[model samples]
Target: MRCLYLWVIIALFLMTTCPSAHADEAVATQSFWAGLSTKAKFQGEVVSNLVGGLASGSVGNALFIGGFSWDSERAGEWHGGKVVINFLAVDTGNPEAYVGDIQGVSNLTTVDSLMRLYRLYYRQRWGQVTERLGLLNANDYFDNAGVACDLLNASFGIVPVLSQNLQGMPTYPFSSLGSMVALGGGDTTLQAGVFGADAVHPWQQPFSQGVLMML
Candidate 1:
């Protein structure tokens, strides 16, 4: 466990520092605009059962996220083209076990401790119209309310109607293969996509697993 933390820190340091290692001015100017981001958060909670819930216990956990984005136009390639990659790693521990509910007290909790590719997608835009494809989190495009982000409750992040009922409503920890298109910009935009129902194994039963369509 400590080794995992060490490696993740080292990897993040290398990613941020190595990109500018090239001293050649010409090479630097020609290279695409690559942006890197990393986040490390540690959270602890105490649950007191004054009534009939779960047991009164406490748990502590950590979450690490890293991401990179490249702009093609900056590299002298075609305009309106970009690529994004994201990775997520969570320390083992279920905060919900102390709360006795599945909705979850911590948004970072997953079925199991996991470190996987969270999102890898390509986006292209032509005027007000934009398109994206590959492993995606549906929450990024739909039901995304900026005002509710600061809340810690899992249900506050997304509506239960979709998260609980929608078979494969792509949310955190389980992005699935999908494609989306959007028109318009600013205050109003029309967007839609078809995503694989089985987010855990998107490749299995690709067609029969059902699909999630949002508009």
Candidate 2:
């Protein structure tokens, strides 16, 4: 519950490396994995629970997320097809039990510590329009905030209201089956999608419930 917001904080502080596109092009055709552009990040943080209660002790958490993408156009003449995959892992202490902080420390921290497949989807682009299907995270396409990263609060990663109200709305750490359509110009854009309302892991009973639409 309160442990959910921590993941967004980690996303705000993610670190990465840069490589030449030409360099990757040189090796992309050499191997299957070679064509996949992969990114990995690690994050850690601790939150203090002052004046909350006797259990208001400091707690910490760590996160590991790795993601990779394969461009069908880059792989060959496969046109506008692309595949993406991601993995997220989090470990956290029971700080809420002590401090009763509802906001949580790191968005990724959960009561249970386990690694899971984060996002896996296929997307196709035609000019400015794009279509995506399969396991999806709505947060990847809608209402994203850059300023939220500058602060420690998790609600900054995604809109706090949507994050709290949406039932499934595939998002960070967990994804649900869904699809999205994007049409845009230089300034204004329209994007919408439907995602499973169930927050459970996609690998387990993924389609057992009604779907929720994101507009």
lDDT leader? 1
Q: Candidate 1: minimum summed lDDT over ten consecutive residues — where?
A: 32-41
Off by over 4 Å in 2: 1-28, 31-34, 52-54, 166-169
lDDT of 2 by residue, 184-211 (tens): 7567778889887775656567667777
On the 0 to 100 scale, the lDDT of residue 150 in model 2 is 36
- C-alpha lDDT of all candidate models, in order: 0.75, 0.73
Top candidate on TM-score is: 1
TM-score of 1: 0.75
Against the true structure, candidate 2 has what lDDT? Answer: 0.73
In candidate 1, list every pair of residues with a backbone clash. Answer: none
Q: What is every candidate's alpha-carbon RMSD to the true fold?
A: 14.0, 18.5
lDDT of 1 by residue, 1-215 (tens): 99999999999998887766754554656574432333444444433345556666666656676777777876767889888888878775666666788666766666778888888899999999999998999888888877765436677777778887865667877788999999999988999898887777766675467888888
Going through the candidates in the order shown, the clash numbers are 0, 10
